[model samples]
Target: MKALSYLNKYLVKYKWYLIWGTVFTAISNLFGIFPAQLVRYALDLVRETLDTYHLYDGSTLQPALYSIFAFSLLLFAGGTLALALLKGFFLFLVRQTLIVMSRHIEYDLKNEIYDHYQTLPLSFYRQHNTGDLMARISEDVSKVRMYVGPSIMYGVNLIVLFILVITYMVSINARLSAYVLLPLPILSVLIYLVNNIIIRKSEEIQASLSKMSTYVQEAFSGIRVLKAFVQEQQSAARFEVESDTYRAKSLSLTKVDSLFFPIVAILVGLSNILVVYIGGQEIIAGRLTPGNITEFILYVNMLTWPVMALGWTTSQTQRAAASQARINEFLNIKTNIVSKKDINRSIQGEIDFRNVRFVYPDSGIVALHNFSMHVKAGETVAILGTTGSGKTTLANLLTRMYDVSSGEIRIDNTPIVDYNLTSLRSQMGYVPQDVFLFSETISNNVRFGRPDLPQARVEQAVRDADLYQNVIDFPEGFDTAVGERGVTLSGGQKQRLSIARAIARDPRILILDDCLSAVDTNTENIILNNLRRIMADRTSVIISHRVSSAKLADYIIMLDEGTIVEEGTQAELMARNGAFRELYEKQLQTEEV
Candidate 1:
């Protein structure tokens, strides 16, 4: 019922076609009953002649026999042709309309889901697997489409056919119809019970399938690691477990299907027996005309399809219901982040955090607490921190990935939340710790941040990021394809491309979050020098563990356990002999040795 409600909007549009299709079905059934009446009438005429051979005129039977034969032949031929045409036309229109509606619904749902995903906090992705989310968007949404297209239409057709058949039967002979329909109520009850089981089992099956999809995606994505570590056998075994679970659930569903069909057959057979036995008795007792009896039997036969269809419809409806529930659940998940409608008028590069605190939605421990920072416009500041010292958390706060649980963050004298998200993000260029590239050409990847920039400008940015020579070395130059996640490129090349993307944006605030770590000292120095010259007027935040990188900044802040323990110039911090000095001394010793 709930699933049907989801499809009501489309159903309303095509209801007229359904009504006419059903009328044609009823007309076909009526014409089908005539042949049986002819048979019974011929049998009666023969019996009459046998009783009075001498008195009966053989000529009198000819016209009646001829009329019966002609009427049956014409009705059967015409009705069959008309039914075929009607069914074809109706089914064609309905299927095409459903396809269109499904496509439109899919478009709307995908856009809505994607838009919601964009607004959701980073914490959501941290807890959820990429494969599972992809499955929901692609596979689960497809299930909803299937339900809307075929399942809803067929289910409604079955119900309408059943009601029409039952109404015709009751009008012909109420008692006989009641006796034949005894099994129908029982069948309905049985279907109800099966539907409950099917829904539960279908949900379990879909869940297992999702897990299988996730496992396959993960294994294939990490195939290189599995082979390098000789974990191929282990990976195969794990995949087999997930696959076997999927097969088991499918088999269980089939078992339920096996039981369903047999029960439906039995109930239909019982209905046939009641119609034949009771209607035959009426003929013997002369209480009913033979033609009438034959018509009743024909009606019973015509009704078998609708009865069978009822059972099949029940199964499809249950599966669709389960799918709808899953789809709706995903659609209903609210995004943790919300953007304001108004844009901040003056968004200078100045950024300030006043005792801001944050914890991941699923975690109890706070990632950042009482973290205060102030940066003036056009200042190149370096943040030095150990692993898990809240450096990334601080960067995320600047972008409002997770809103502060307490205190506030302000940008250009306006609260961060006051600015529209698009406007706020446009003012900043962020390079993440991990550089991700699309499987596209080199030029496309470089120009990703500012797609509308002139080609010459993109070439200049590529040169500034120290990647122009690398790009030219490829046979296809800028047109060379970067494989998935830039797998074709070396680590340093990927990092350099990421830097080029950020530099192309030309944002007011440029943030490089340890983006230079993959490159060697010489390449890093070249890139840093280029960035310093290009981004001299921009407010820059450089996050790194290396003191050499920190030394390039105007001022340095050393973070420890989510707190700023030391803040000074590089020379002053080294003189004080704190965490930065200790890290610098260790690197110097490694270099000397």
Candidate 2:
């Protein structure tokens, strides 16, 4: 219940809907009670009329009395029919206000969660998986909506109906009313016990749902790997295990839920029996009439739905509370990465890293240890490093994807954190080692950073990356669809397309992170020739292990572990005959072979 209290702000936001809905519920129930009272009045009127007719058995007045009684009964029936129609209209209004407001809240809540997800740091993604995140936003929010819409609606309807029906019953006959309501306390106790089980089971079900979603999502995303390894049967068996767990928990909850209606039905049946038996005894004592017995029976039937719905409303509320608590877990997390200032200053591409030390939070492995470098404006610096030598960490740190652990990085002599986060990233283009492209047309993927870019610019970027000829050969040319993650493209083609995307941004600072590794030497040489011309005035950092890739750089740094081992121009490092020279000789022999 306390977890459900989080929705109070949303209720306040749409308070007018709640107010109008409550008013309509009360009016409908008031009208609903009137038909039972009308039945009572008509029954009593008939009895009195019958007695009067007997007294005037052979008189002229008897004809007039009979006509009057027929007209009176017709009026009673018409009045009851009219009240019923009005009640139906107001009930329509109740749903219109409350249910529609719940939909609006659902829309707002989903957008809020999505926007928060975008703000979370890269580390946050590593800590949590994609499927659980999706479950919280989609499935969990839907459960909360059940409480907002139907539970609230029915709960209010029950409360209002009970007050009106019970007060009228007691006013007519206190002892009979007591007997009719004798099962209520027992119903309350049953609901209390059942709701605890419902909420606990609901939490377990939601957790299992998240696990199942994660497994399916991962399986689909890595279908290629599964096929390559011939693990189809194994994957299917794993999925079945998850599915069975979810199904078992669901069946357990259903078994408990099945008890609700029957319990309500038996209790409601008992109340009806009590009303008839006690009212008939009162009549025999001359304290009540046949009309009274009929009226009490009608009221008991009128109370049937609300009492039955109580169990359903409580079940929905318990599930909602369980779901909301899960939603709150993510919402409450405060992201560590946020812009320190709102400044959006232009960058001159003078980058500097000073005594930087960083350790991965999750793995506790030091990725960079006292690493320092400086790149002058319009200069190209190549970093040569083997795997695990921390080449990619430089790009991540400069982009502020993760902040520095100890020392600082700066662009144009200002701390990277001082610039607006969006502005800083916009001025730089990065091509990652592992290329990724959306499921869109080639042209769209190329110019993803600038959707409004002209066709001429898009074609020029593709041509510069040496992918123009291949793209134009396709049937649809630039309009051809690249399947998820560019699965339609070969490995070299995907890398070239990623390069085209980065170049299309026309960034002042470009980071090419082993992006050309998949391409052949001839294509790599041609793309590098184009880049040398295109990047003549912009600063660039080329990270690679091949000495051929470092030939055009103004300076080269060879790294071992997380620290720089050699720093010089190509000729200078080769002349030293150290680690750089050894690697270059090995690659030269491999190229020849």
Candidate 3:
């Protein structure tokens, strides 16, 4: 019961289901116990040789010996059959009510974990592996259900059966009842000791499983790289290590479990032996009748089931406790990114960065240093930078993906954090350098940002991405399924679809981070042509390495080592031989080749 407290909230919600199931369970066990009483009456009737027997109505039932035996046998058979069916009916109710509730609770818990996973800060995902998270949600959730369902059912049934059976046994004969139950308390102590070991070993086993899952998931995700590098054998050898660890920990848990049931069998067997041995002595001394001894034996048989079940239920309980602790590890993490209350400010896309600074927590390196910039509500500002030059970092700050370590970023004169997170993010469109598409239809992917947008808008966005030619080539047109992470599509197609998604949002501000790098100048021109109308009334920040995109911008800024080295209209920067001009010349020379 103490171990079950980890799921206390869920238990409380389904308390009515549990109570009804217990009621049915009580009825089932109560019906099953009456057979022992019938056996007693039969044994005593045999002892009296049909001379002292009476009917259930307290009237004399004297008759010929063979006639009495036949009638008694018939009555016993009919009563037992009726009781069996009644017990079966209640057992069905128990399963439907309690087991079904456990399943529902499992779904609730898993969904709650997944929803929390979505709200967690991106840094939390960086620190945790996919396999570990998967194991917690799938494997751990199942174990918690096991504890509440089978463990609770068997555990409560054992207790309730014991109270009813023992009270009846006492009414028959107190001394014999005490003698038969003497070994039970000691057996309980043995179960406790074994369960302690089981809990410890189960925790270790679950951890090893998580590690193995992580290894398998990551290894397969990089299978293409492994094959390309001809490292198949090396990868297999690494997997062998994880598999071996998992197997070894599972065996250790099994080793502890092996000691439990046999000890319970031996102790319970002793109770039966003591019951028969002492009752036989009393019968021979003429103090107890043959009928009493026979009934006691039947009662002892009933006791064995609950005694054995106690060992199983306790072990199951310990396993659930171990899994619950692992799940809590994820649930207890504080959500790193949280919003303030009553923030309903709408953004109009005038952006400002005033002396902003940020250091990546994982690497402890400053990606941006005192970066300051301003863009009017409807200006096109192209950003130029070498690798590691903080272009993408600036875009991230404007969206408040990560709060700046120092200074402030503002949209329409309000701090980025002052507006509602959902409203602020929905107003801006962002296409990252690394594009990710779900395993969904091309049109569905394009419609992701605004699902309610019309199909005409989806086609328009796809045209703006210069994907019209590619869409017509595929047999499925917009309905084609992109494989996992859009692996079935070419890199350029994926980037175009990402652009289509952002474009369909009709954002107030659009940030494209080197989004047109994979396409040729002809397609880039087509994209630029389509985006001109969209960018005319919205703030656009285009990060590009190509001179074609830069020359079309109203202003371009060159970033070198997290600082602004040059900023002006493209023609002005090209007039002076600056970093931007040098990049422009290099791209022109490369294209001439």
How does each model score on lDDT?
A: 0.77, 0.92, 0.84
Tens-place lDDT per residue, model 2, 198-230, is 989999999999999999999998999999999
For candidate 2, list the clashing residue pairs, or say none.
Answer: none
Q: How many Å off is the CA of 272 in candidate 2? A: 1.2
> Residue 221 lDDT in model 2?
88
RMSD of every prediction: 3.5, 1.8, 3.2
For residues 1-593, write the lDDT of model 3, one tens digit per residue: 45456588998899998999889888988988887777777777676755544443354444464576878877987887889889889889989888988898899999989998887766687788999999999998898888888888887788888988999988877888899989888987888888888988888888888888998898787777889999999889988988898899889888878787788788878887887898888888777887887778878787787878888778888888888888887887877555655377656789888998888766688888788888889988998898899988887777777888889888888777677888888988999998999989998998898888888999999988989889978999989999778878988899999999998999999999999988888888888988998898899999976768875588888887788899999889989998888888898898888
Query: Which regions in candidate 3 have their CA more than 4 angstroms from the true location?
Result: 1-6, 50-65
Give the lDDT ranking, best first: 2, 3, 1
Task: For candidate 1, give the lDDT of residue 309.
Answer: 68
lDDT of 2: 0.92
lDDT of 1 at 134: 80
RMSD of 2: 1.8
C-alpha lDDT of candidate 1 relative to the true structure:
0.77
The estimated TM-scores of all candidates read 0.89, 0.96, 0.93
